[model samples]
Target: MVKVKKIIFLALGFPNAEENTIIWTDLVHEFHLQGHDILVVAPASNKTDTGLRLEAGVKVLRVATYKLFDVGPVLKGLANIMLPYQYKNALKINNIKLDFDLILIPTPPITLGKTANWLKRKTKAKLYLILRDIFPQNAVDLKMISQGGLIHRYFRKKELKLYRISDKIGCMSQANIDYIKTHNPKIEAAKLHLLPNWENLPKFEDLGNIDDIKAKYGLTNKFVVIFGGNIGRPQKMENIIELAKNCTEIKDLVFLIIGKGTEFKKLKDNVTSLKLFNVVLEKKIPKKDYYNLLRAADVGLISLSEEFTIPNFPSKVLSYFGSKKPVLASIDLQTDFGQMLEETNSGFWAEAGNIPLLKEKLMLLYKDGDLRSKLGANGYKYMAENLLPEHAYNIICKNV
Candidate 1:
């Protein structure tokens, strides 16, 4: 008989409702059915207020954190920096003791590696580091940190140490792998695995009519350009606001901005102060409502600042594809996101921060009904065949 492996996944956060829960939940369930026991540890970020809701035979352990202003990079960094000690204490408080066969941790603050490292030392478990963000390099790329400064040097050392300690590494984008190889040639090619972002299509069902939803928000019969998720620096949504302002004369066009971030209030304030007619700003919605809103949207607006190139793939693209809504992608004209949108014929891409180009593309997609249908349908087919949860699980299982 094959021996069943015990698995533990550690991440600072997991989508308790809509984010990546659809994808991760399925994978955990499948692993359980395959006879492996799974445990997940994540920080509770407003999603699990009523304690833990059980699902898929896997046990989740979540701890509450302060959802203050610095939640994304700053607060997240502090939380992750303290993760090793916090996780150690959390495990102890729960009275959990285990010698796991495998441990997986996603890198962001790159501090989870310390927790993984600790678990390895304590239990002799195999550590698999999941590279969601390339860390110091991405931070530098976004001008968030100076490349040669002390902070950069510190993060660089931490990133390298994590990579060295990991028994296996899983990357979300091929560019991420290539970037790593370029920087550290000693990294064995076989140690790196490419597992791109994926979508869980079955979890979403059409909510039938969006007329009532639009009416509630005063968006009925408008060309709603829905842009959801974090409105941070990397998105640089100012130009999108400019476009919305320019298009105020057109009553049919409306921009719906949802989700929370450091930059969210700034964007909202700008629209409010300027009295921009076609803009409607909203905070993050519940998972089901968010999915329904995406389904109801006439165009999905995806924005990323021009600054980032490597390690900048947006998970929102997969969600847009799964929703079968044509996307309006704004990113570095040279990156994978732009190329993917162009190659798939699913959306129109404009140079990031180029308001005129954005306006033109938006008008084009808005006017061409047949083109929109064809593009949306094409995207759904591509997602079904390529970016489904099964594809991600297969890649992970192969690595295991």
Candidate 2:
């Protein structure tokens, strides 16, 4: 017999639909399947009303707030700063309150300390911080905000407050745990827990008619190297553009970059200006279609800006793993993402900005179908053993 607990999740971005296979939704779905009572509190589109609604048997409280996610940095930053107050107010108006055992908060907005504090005081819930994005520093790394500048200093204080209230801070990688400990020594070391991203591993059988799916999306008859997810600054989409340019001479090999972000136009403009016909860029497709396109690919592509000092473990890589796709990554030296790839022998990686070496490695995979299959299978196995939703659920339940 298992105990059913009440859990509430606070997030800036959510999949919003069960059909969408996002990291947050995947883990929450695990709790759902286990018979836990789960509620997700998230930002609503400007067009959406603030209220409670049912989404795939889950209760979702959509808080009315400023601009939807993936907007320009100026609006996005301002909106995050304003969300805590808005979230706190929304709960007051709803009047459908109940006792909650745990408050799970994932950071990107990183300004939820106030809301967490309010919820803790009101519901007596234990707080767990999933530190997905190390703010101010990540912003500083991308030169989006200057170090010690007013914006940086303000969010830095907010980050510390968010940490102070968390009973345990779950990090995506050991590098992330080490970085947090070294940078924020004031926080107790034991508070940081390694909670890597997890996903619902779907079987290949569910992919459904690979050739039909690929032809549907114009991905057939090519060795597709797909990069599917957010195209934000931290991703350093320029490296991808340059790689596409360098790979122009290679026939039948196309770089498929799917997803939308602030930098999408810049990437599209570069592709147009450079006349790189081999690189296909699309705004993100429907969830299952994206998965099918990923599975149809010869390999998955991952990139991080060379400027990043924080170790970014992109959860999207799990999407690649779930699809049994090998990876070709251009990563920052500090990230340890490449290290994970090497440890599993799942893909090829070179330091970010090393176009020549990345090209060489890409060619190695391009020429060897057997190597791709072996590595892709290895990645799928690695994901099943270590990064499944059930595994993550067990870890979080133990903490709860």
Candidate 3:
């Protein structure tokens, strides 16, 4: 018989949000199915109040906190710094007590070290750090924050403390693992592991009415290329807009951008000013509707800022694969996402900021139906075989 363990998960987002399909939700569900007791401490959205609830064998504690991602840099940083104290206060007020066997945390804030350390000291829980975004360094790479600046130094100190507190650190890709090791030479090699983001195999219900979706979006008879989810600074969406601008002559091609972020307004303004008839920008749709839109499109587009030295992998590619849509990604050369596509025969890739190459890729996919079908199928197959919640669960179980 497997020994059941109690797990504590820390994250910024959780289920029942406007968009619910994400890495943490899937993994927590999988752990529940495996008969492990789980507790999730997540931030409450603007619409939600601080509370406790039970859902699908997982106990959720929603801590009332400032909106972390949608605010200004100063506000965001302040929230990140204060989240641990808020979480601790919530736990105390609720009189919640448990001896957790494992504590799992993902980083964007890198300020959860104090909470994790407290839990470890109190309950002897083994802390596992899911190192998704490499915090201050990524900010520095994007020139969002300067290296050795006050903000950078403060977060860097927090980053190191988090790493030191973790018993194990799981990276999203091999490239992520290497980047961490290279930058933080003090961190022991034994603590690092590759723990890629995962999702369940596509369910029949997820594939909504493709024809109706295409018509609703006015994508009928057009070779639709979609860039979905979080159109922000890190995405370097200007490259995609440039690609759309260059392809205005091709009446059959339509660039459908569905999502919102800090850069959404800027992108929309540029699209309107340029009079790019071939491009359409829409707010993020419901999760089900987004999947339907993916089914309606001929290609899925992924992009990262060319300025990044970090090999960031976007989880959006998995959604594209789930829809069996071929992907066309423009990523930093340092990122191994392009290599993943080539090795899997799942999609095509071009260097980020290379509008000419991006345009060439678009035209190639537009002209070839057979090539699109083959690549899409390959991606679906690869995802089904490799990127599953069960795989991620097993990795965590072994480490714990």
- Per-model TM-score, in order, reads 0.89, 0.95, 0.96
Q: Write the per-residue lDDT of candidate 1 for residues 262-282, one digit (tens) a residue.
A: 798898889889999799888
The clash count of every prediction, one per candidate, is 0, 0, 0
- Worst lDDT window (10 residues) for model 1? 47-56
lDDT of each: 0.76, 0.85, 0.86
TM-score of 1: 0.89
* Reference-based lDDT, residue 210, model 3: 82
Q: What is the per-residue lDDT of model 2 for residues 140-164, given as tens digits with 9 covering 90 to 100? A: 9988889999999899998999998
Error of 1 at 57 (Å): 3.5
Stretches off by above 4 angstroms in model 1 are 1-4, 15-26, 44-56, 64-76, 93-95, 202-208
CA RMSD, predictions in order: 3.1, 2.0, 1.8
Point out the higher-scoring one by TM-score: 2 or 3. Answer: 3
The all-Cα superposition gives candidate 3 an RMSD in Å to the true structure of: 1.8
Candidate 3's residue-wise lDDT over 1-400, tens digit each?
1244888898777864223657888999888888888889988765466688875557889899877887887898888889999988888898878688888898776898888888889888889998889889888987889999998999999899899889899888999999889989999888999888799875657466788888888888888999888988999899898888788888888989999898999999998899998998889666666778877889999989999988899998998998898999999988899999999998999998888988788778888999999999999999888889999988877876
